[model samples]
Target: MSTVTTATNATTTHRSARSVARRTAWLAGALFWSAFAVLEAVNHGWLAGTLALTFFVLPDLTFLVALDDAPRMAKGQLPPCAVPYYNALHRALVPLALLVAYTVQPFFAWAPLFAALCGWMAHISYDRAFGYGLRTKEGFQRG
Candidate 1:
């Protein structure tokens, strides 16, 4: 093969490896956080379980905020107005920060909010594992 072809192949291989690593890491995070949420529910009470389930499904509901704009968006694009809410919920740091705060100083009786954070993190992790991520300001998935 020519040098250019070899270089292209190498770059592609490197990117493929990085993608696989990223997906694998996110998958692991999903599994761990999901399991932790489940355990919290079992150990705590119905409120913990309910909050966990709620937060798990809450992030995607941001789409409803701009449902009327969907018709004008490009394929696979979120509505621009909903992008901020979607990006905010999909950010792992948000839940991670809350989790750290809970650990440092418990609140909401600890278990329910903790479980919710775990579920939220699990949702984000699963999205990342499946190659979904925060959108750009224009609502397209960031490359």
Candidate 2:
């Protein structure tokens, strides 16, 4: 094979590896969260556990709806703002805010605040584990 062909093949293989690794990481994260939610439900109750799972997965859902690059940037549509709106939901502050609210009130008949907090943490962990760090205003993929 020509040098150019060899380089292209290497690049394609690298990208394929990265894609596979990313997908695997995502699958692992999903399994982890599902197991956690199930265990929580078994210990607590169904409603609270489901709520926790929903909160845990909320950031990704919001990102898919609002800030994902494929539907926006790939289509040549500029984002309305420099920072992606999803970043706001993905930060540690989300869980901190939940913690503060729980501290202030401490009253819950169902769906404890801890579940939401755990969900936020799980989201962050999954992103970090999968190498999906925070996106900068400059591009779709950045720390």
Candidate 3:
């Protein structure tokens, strides 16, 4: 299900309930990712195991932040945030994919891996489906 609610601020006004809904949707996406960490801990090992999972996530953070400027610098907001979103999903899905390739002992290690990939894919698809993408034109007009 989806919703469309509008809010106006003294400093700014958002157009369409879609903007707020988009933001709310992204928040939920992040929350879902964080929640995956918790579930991963239980399935993969526990608190310590999840901490070990951090080893996988940390490099991803570095790469994502490091590349944050590259796309903007190159595209000048041309390709827009589709680059970051795609990269973020790749950053997330890659390790999870590796986990799938390397996991042993229990079969469920792949579950969180699968969930993370699904979440990433779903968010990207949602954004694309809803026409929610970074602005590409100069002085991008307000919604």
Candidate 4:
């Protein structure tokens, strides 16, 4: 009976921890996108600004679709072992990709791509500012 109680407590604690992780991740993501959209809308047209914001969130949305536990992780339900995937999507690869694209086609300015990159940077900045960091196999922790 004592062992059973101990196991139950441990499980509850683990679930709580995962929940915190997911909520924080979602908060950070939301903050980034919101701030980015507002900033872009001030400088660009509303439609373009929102479209850029969508592009910024596209990678994360893709992960949510591809990973079984991604939504759960975002909701703080279960610990996710998706650190690598998260890192890949959150990194500066989008900007770099845009740079490469521009280099390949010097005539095309690719303003929209640049806007998306800005949105991506905004998201990463928000995550760092909010202490969401990244997830690990065990759980989310500050990096």
Candidate 5:
């Protein structure tokens, strides 16, 4: 094979490996965090459990913000108006940051906040493991 062909093959191989690693990492995260959230609920109270469950389903509710536009869009695409909300909610950093904040300040009641963050992280992790991720400005999954 030509040098260019060899380079292309190497790049593709690298990307494929990275993709597998990424998916595996997220899957592990989903399992751990989801379990952590459940444990927190069992240990703490209904408040902890309820908040965790609520936040897990909350991110996807952004779709309701642009329901009318959803029909015209391609499958797996968020409407442009809802893209910002979807992207923000889907990002792991947001919940991670909140968890850090809770650690630093201890301002909120601990158990519920912790459980909610864990659940949110679990949701994001599951989405990533399944190949969903933050949307592009055009509302399509980023390449």
Candidate 6:
């Protein structure tokens, strides 16, 4: 193998380690918040729970998307198409889903808080499994 290839491989491996460390810490935090959401949902019944799930869980996931973009974009990538993507998840998809699940749904209604909470968890889990969020010698981009 060539020297450059070897060095590149080593760097990639090292970066992967750093990324995983960052991702792990991030995921741990998400888990804590997700747990809080679940507990709150249980207590609040529906409306409050739904709000809490969106307010709490969405941020947790959006963070992962931020993390994923770090290596590619040195600039803080705050979900470039975030508003549209977020709308799809929180507004269009979720409400429609809720309507299908429980008919006679009312406006200003809270859907399944558990489902929203799960959505957040899914993001964290997906990053942990696939993100390879490694820190590089270039270091993390600072805002």
Top lDDT prediction, candidate number: 1
lDDT of 2 by residue, 1-143 (tens): 69999999999999989877876776676566556656666777766677777877777654444454545464433343534655776676667666567667747324445665666666775776666766666436562
- Per-model TM-score, in order, reads 0.95, 0.55, 0.36, 0.49, 0.93, 0.40
Better model by lDDT, 1 or 5?
1
Instruction: List model 4 lDDT by residue over 1-143, tens digit each.
Output: 99999999999999989867876766775676556556656666766576677766765553453466655555542244555667666665555576467668867564555556667766665665565555555545644
- Of candidates 3 and 1, the better by TM-score: 1
RMSD values for the candidates in order, in angstroms, are: 1.2, 6.6, 9.8, 9.5, 1.4, 12.9
- C-alpha RMSD (angstroms) for model 4: 9.5
lDDT tens readout by residue for model 1, 1-143: 69999999999999999999999999999999999999999999999999999999999999999999999999999999999999999999999988888888745457889999999999999999999999999999998
Where model 2 places Cα greater than 4 Å from the true spot, the runs are 1-39, 64-72, 75-83, 100-105, 108-111
Q: Stretches of candidate 3 above 4 Å error?
A: 1-14, 46-109, 115-143
Reference-based lDDT, each prediction: 0.95, 0.64, 0.47, 0.62, 0.93, 0.51
Q: If the candidates were sorted by their TM-score against the true structure, best first, what order would they fall in? A: 1, 5, 2, 4, 6, 3
The alpha-carbon deviation from the true structure for residue 9 of candidate 3, after best TM-score superposition, in angstroms, is: 13
Residue ranges of candidate 5 with Cα displaced over 4 Å: none
What TM-score would you give candidate 1 relative to the actual structure? 0.95
- Residue 139's lDDT within candidate 5 is 90
**Better model by lDDT: candidate 3 vs candidate 4:** 4
True-vs-predicted CA distance for residue 120, candidate 5, Å: 0.3
lDDT of 6 by residue, 38-70 (tens): 665676667646765565456335345446554
Ranking by lDDT: 1, 5, 2, 4, 6, 3
Which consecutive 10 residues in model 3 have the weakest lDDT in total?
A: 1-10
- Candidate 5, residues 43-90: lDDT per residue as tens digits? 999999999999999998999999999889998788999999998899
lDDT-superior candidate, 4 or 5: 5
For model 1, where is the 10-residue window of minimal lDDT? 101-110
